[model samples]
Target chain A: MSAVRERNSSAWLLPPRPGVDHGLRKDMRRFEDQDEVDIAIVGCGAGGSTMLQRLARAGWTAVGFDAGPFWDPERDWVSDEAGSHHLYWTEPRVIDGTDPVPLGSNNSGRGVGGSMVHFAGYTPRFHPSDFHTFTADGVGADWPIGYSDLRSFYEDIEEELPVAGEAWPWGDPHKYTYRPHPVSGNGEIFLRGAFASGITAKVGPVAIANGRFGNRPHCIYRGFCLQGCKVNAKASPLITHIPDALAHGAEVRADSMVTRIGFDERTGKATGVHYVRAGVERFQRARIVAVAGYSIETPRLLLNSANARFPEGMCNDFDQVGRYLMVQGAPQTAGRFAAEVRMYKAPPPEVSTEQFYETDPSKPYKRGFSIQTVSPLPITWAEHVMAQGHWGAELRRYMSDYPHWACLGALCEFLPLAENRVSLSEEKDRHGLPVAKFSYSQCENDQQLLKAAQSVMERILTAAGAEETMTVKRYAHLVGGARMAADEHHGVVDSSCRSFAIPNLYITDGSVLPTQGSANPALTIMALAARTAAILVKGD
Target chain B: MSLPLSPRDGGERYPGFSSVDESDHWDRATQGAVLVRLGLPPDIRFFTAREEAVARALFDQLLDQHSDPRVPVVNMVDSRLAEAETDGWRYADLPEDGQAWRETLAALDQDATERHGQGFPEVTLDQQASLLRAVQDLGYAKWHGMTAARVWSLWTRYACTAFYSHPWAWDEIGFPGPAYPRGYKNLGLDRLEPFEVRDARPAQDPAANAGGDG
Candidate 1:
């Protein structure tokens, strides 16, 4: 066998080295020659990585399979372009072709660290109303659990991740004493601007310990966290829980693409997972299976796993596996200044204002919006600005001084719409697996809310001394395709992240988000993963 | 957020550089020498030629056509020489010896002035002759230094590093300068006069005329 093939096959033999966990080494060894494992986790990203660590600590023998390679701080950033595309495990040719092509939505990673490696590190708890969004607003279905139920779990996640910034007094409060310090100048400017215009704004927490409590180093303000942190400061799945899990004896296999969830002839539960390794198809049996391959890939796997007993595909009895998609508003606005302001040299903005988070009884829409601050570099700003025809030397002259620009955008809450769905496309990959195609449209209420939020953004920027401004029309905050609820009829999973029909199967990614909150979803997803782990540990 | 000192604050001061003696003749020569070391084509003839009137006339004509004449001309000459040298032009390659380089520069300066003078009208010959005399008395080295300094100042303002390789300087200027040209009015103009607002001309209403005819 070639060196690369040998490396791929022997990946599991290398025991978890110190500080390098996430079960990658262990998984590689467990599946090196064996045909099956006791339990299999389909993804090695944020949710999957977290689950693997928990399972390993609990002495559950599990293996993880991902389509991409392990995270290497030096090689990953230098080789990969800094954008949303870096999140996925795509072919080289596809990456080359899609480098310049902008997409409408961002997806999760397919590598060792998975999407969590590229996450912006913004973490926030879902409010009480977020859990009962459907009951409160009569929009989507209610989650199986409430905010009160998940509060302690949220604290656990915060401690594990060691988030920065203080908790909001008005929002779901936490007992954790560690609060992130006040956000820097740019963040304060955004909050001030929002408050000046009657919008409630406050400092929000991010999973950036910055060397306060963890072995991870402090943020160097390199402004390239999305590309992968070179200093290992940010709490990505690879850096945090994944290593601990691997040290505790969990195995993680990189570049092993799981094709289907194989089931036994007599039993309805999954018996094993069929995966492709170095062009060889192999079946690995496990007592329990966790499909943490994200909303997109998880459903695609199930839809492809067709058989004689379950003709419609695994867990397709209700045909509600890929329904009720919710995506947040993509509305954004930017402003330019006269002096130098190096906004891109620091971590992403640490403050967020959710004054309009709840539904207004008088308004046409049932849910309000949340506005957050972000600072981008000149090149990114130029591309977005020039897309609106602000081009040529005039634009160049305006961008000559750094740090003279700032932006505020709204993540408008999206109601779960059943018509928005994910389906297998006619397009196939090199392995003959069908690609996931998404069909989505915003409701009239969603559009109105987005429009109102955009106007508010414009007014805030104008008040903050912005001479010029512009907005991005479409958003990419994809959420809620495989929602969680109390019953199988209305949702795919329950509050504990377990599928309503399958006893052992669970999903801890954005797939279980019933209602899209008006904020970044990373924090909520982390909180849910922690909550799921707690529930499983308590044997509930 | 206090704005940096205005451009008139003797331009942004650079450390380890003398700004006290603006009229010091030697300061100009040193500036011109630095530009030459940075691969720029120095005006060697400006430091050697005896006829002040002819030199002054040529300098004035160059300044009139190109707002900042020194660096632009040097850049053009260096680029042409580089191309010619690459193409194996005999005269394009400078000698290893410093003196030989100086001689070649002097010859190129003479050729440049002849080409520039060829474009002017014959009626302005007498006026040009008098200005050339004044330039000769000013001393060639002194004049060349002053011109080089002015060019460097303009280039630095736009964040260009034709004479410097400091990355910090590039970052300060926000790198790529203005995307649009300052336009015809700013080019070579000594002063920027206020523009007069003109009333809009009546719209050419072809429809109105056509209706009346119908």
Candidate 2:
């Protein structure tokens, strides 16, 4: 007992280190501007963080640059929704088109963990058909790599995140690591509705911890998942990968915004990156540069990095850098019930069903949507109430009845349209770079799918004994600006997420997805980063 | 009026639920942050005196807060604008949120002078709401060189954000505020945490009695 007692503390089951000791080390190794590392990753979010960890473990020196702060969640995050707006990338961007997607905390984040810090912790994997939508349903573009390629990475990341849920019967039919957390009142209403509607539902696969794995604690059921988890119960790269990456000798430089990828004119390969830290411009040299700035910033960086060698952009030789931008049609329906469904008491994501993920012959749409319980806080609920044309006394009245309402969101797979894209606007940011001007409009298919999804949501709510229901049209999870394809003629990157135009440059974020499925994009984005890091380690 | 769990005039739905009491059980950081909403609001720094008057009237109409013990929404909104805590993206057609707020407030006064022969704050609540409704009815049409619908979105978005972040508003909504260290264990349908109070008017359809300019 005395000899093996220390080893039996279950500490060996944890990933490299207990995640709580994320102290911003003052004496950590810092590379000079002229020192060339093995890899320089832009945006230390899901993709960059994952790649940095893998590459560091393989004995490759790596550095990551993020425009946001390296957050100590306990200090930086609060339980209040309005106080948590600092975590989002709230830089001024221009939005246009028939349906302008509202860009703020919902879809964009700025900190070391990126959007996952504020994301609702729903980490469902994309369906197998999502890899080949063109082959299966004859609609959207097929991914260069199939679901089988990212399956192992997904499994590994799931164990790393320690995802909690019941055994999933949808998509590829997998089991999560931890048993499902208890369902909240909002989730119960959703399950009740799905059962009544003859649709099967399951309790989560959210990346939030159920009990405990490492130094991270269990979820507090505080209902502030979108406002950055201060309890260390949720999974963000800041905890899941960055700590391990740091332990393995990866340097993450926070509040340093990478403005452009520096390219060698003669070699046609990436030299490094030009970034700005506290208003001072600097350069970090690297053998390889990976841009993981998600969709908008990734394409924005490529387009802004035009040189004498590639005047159009780094990977825009065939004019496909900022094309095929996509967003899931995330419309929410809130139902008022007789019972108190205090949705803002637990984690926002608790239950989901992918029954309508594939196309049905009876439905007019080619692809379908997934339904999840989305719990909006007070301010968000006010917006939902006002979206239904209620103001004045009506607004106050509806908002006062907030405790009895629960919401359901439908993530309809909007097709990747070339015209719906992110281009550089004339307006400049504080860094003097042209801001991203995102133009979006629903196509005929998108409009139809949304209509179908909204109808189904209303039906489900009505079936669940809702006295009244109101639908709000919104969008979530921006992806696919610098997409991957089989050829350079139609896409920016290749199957390995390497730029076809530049040999050592890679794009390993949601921007490289050829088509985004109805599933949340965080898991797929991380999986892609793992795949890219594996390919790089293989010397391919 | 300052008593615990007192009814808020005639519209109090959760009669005896005090959101401030729930604050005591929160973590120290959260409790400190939330309790500040009850203290003195920030001064109006972004808007002028006239702009402030017009904006306050607009918020009063928007949230239906006609009398005393207001949530200081105008000041909250002013602090946001003065601190540049905008909601990130601005519509390509519109200016930044601060500039748009100024323009819209001035436009409201201009519209009031045109329609009612008085300023927006000087006009009756009925006249002010009708003028606002006219802009809302425009939908996507132009009003004073800016899109009417977007201006409405900006005004309501800021107003709602400010109003709903207060404990007074939370009390009216029966939201047990800031559950951090002390989390709920009872999670089933209609299950209440020990600190949470059940909704008294759960069956009442708020929409049925909803009355405004429309």
Candidate 3:
């Protein structure tokens, strides 16, 4: 038989009901019948899945709904050519642009696993100053909860995700002891060069490679992670928290899109969420509704759920639900070395540097940025470097020889400005829902940070004996649109991720981040979700 | 009787010819042989009118070069030729339905497949079917298909290389090279220059295209 035929035949090796639980079926039926749960989670991505697991473990029943499909690593992993399918979040062109560029990272996974399926799994805690940007830097608002309050939650999230790295040695409260997997050749080179330059660098924790801690297998370092992993290595919500939630009778409904948040006007609280299921609009009522539909869709849902009591939109009484938008603009610099560094085939770069995490008032910017080394495949690297347009012979030659190229990038923090907002576009989808239009820009401080980060990256590359180096100036990682704070007047959600205007509605996604942090936001988002779950379960 | 020129005599007659240059001759000879084996006319003009029109059609058809090789140049040849022909002429000389054109394409496809083990049109069609299957099975078609047309329009306008290399063209028409963008610096069209339309043809030798040193 041909290879294709043999693979097709072997696809049925597993039972039809694989990864399904009897308790989950029962809970799903309960949700279908409109049974009330403690919370109705609107999304099942990274944040929603973590929240469900925490809430369920704390003895609260929850039902999670996601329009995206689940990911099965074994079934999903194919050849490199077919790996692009792993990046599918929503239906292609669902969020239409003239260029058809995907709205976000093929970062979003729809199905059971959500986007955790394709996540790079770098987990870094936000700096202490990140929680109090308004007070410290005189920009953005302060989080109701400080780094001290979230420290324990961050530790819990890291444990749940089972990261491998030594704790921060600088005596920061958020630091914890971790044994990260050994660094690769490129990672080691980056570490040596960064440290030689007096930069604080270490093998930061990644949410992969635990030896069966949470019923998930250890990472096999396949390096095909951006596609789904067949070995259950990556700590995605699908394999980690979602399964735990299901074991505790929590349910998840895939392909179910929540259209609007149902509200009881008299009490000024959300009653339930009305969603579309298989072309039918059905109402699923609950005492509490937690919108974890990510930063963009979370605000879009609030804007779409407008009622007479809150004319602007649900929870938009202050017109601040989608304001204060920020994306972590990661301008990177890459250098080619004369070594046979197979960076692409290895697990993601497990180490990073935080020498620039603090604010540098002497420079043009008040807030600073963090630098990290990452491993990328030839295709991904080519996409980044060639974005400057060095093609044909020069492109082919560069790609063929630069397999050992090392990259140093900065996760620069963007100030949460009120002008950066998400609004409904006049254009509507097939379902007649208004498309989301995002208007965002970087401040002068952000540009300065980028420039300084570039200088730092160039210096490090030069120290590392790099033959050639290039820098990317413009890039973004969407975050901080619906920030969390102490007062409802300044922010949308309160300290515990509860919307002050709507008591029963909680948002635990990137939207609740008070300010953009100079680190990967996934770990922080997971930590916040865990924190919120603890509060809601304790009835605080 | 024309006397056969010795290798030394040939080198003396054509200074560019030498024993060391056999590889270049071999490359040109191989290309000529392949065209002949496929029963295509030596001149690219035999396939279409106007060099630009031929280049565009070749660009569209080249997409299927890797997948199916049974598609005939005749399929893309006539439409381009007809457009060029109409642009150059005021009155209609032949029927626009292009019955002769269709026949020419059918004959070319059949002849090429029989002679050279593959033809452009058949291979192009088969490759397209395969791509559609891949895209549909991966759910890309369902997600991106509705908007792919619009995306293609924008991609063509902004990134012409992307349009030229788009994989979908292999099935729909036989286009090639929609590989991921690499080594492409944004020049912003400021380097536009005029080129003389020369009667000289491009060198068929593979070495001439190698290294791009030429």
Interface RMSD of each: 20.4, 1.8, 17.5
Predicted candidate 2, C-alpha RMSD = 3.1
Candidates sorted on DockQ, descending:
2, 3, 1
Most accurate candidate by DockQ: 2
Tell me the alpha-carbon RMSD of every candidate.
18.9, 3.1, 15.5
Among the numbered candidates, top lDDT falls to 2
- DockQ for every model comes to 0.02, 0.66, 0.03
True contacts kept of each: 0.02, 0.68, 0.01
Give the per-residue lDDT digits (tens) of candidate 2, residues A1-540.
122112121122223322345343443457777999999999999999889888987889899999999887666777887777898889988899999999887799997989998899999999999989898888889888888999998987777776889999988999987888888889989999989998898999899878866667778798888988877788888877876677667898999999999988888789999999999999999999999999899999998998887788778888898889999999999998888888987898999989988888897778889999999999999999898888887777787788889899999999998898889999999999999999999988889988888888888888899988899999999899999999999899999999999999999899999898899999999989998999899993
Q: Candidate 2 has which clashing residue pairs, if any?
A: none
lDDT of 2 at A135: 85
Whichever of 1 and 3 has more lDDT, that candidate is: 3
**True-vs-predicted CA distance for residue A42, candidate 3, Å:** 0.7
* lDDT by residue for model 1 (B1-214), tens: 1112222211122222221222132223223322233254434332233322333333333222212322333333233233321111111122211233244334324534565653223216444433333333343233333332222222121122221122222232232211111111211101111221111111211112222100
For model 2, the docking class works out as medium
- Restricting to chain A, the TM-score for each candidate equals 0.88, 0.96, 0.90
TM-score of chain A of 2: 0.96
Candidate closest to the true structure, highest TM-score: 2
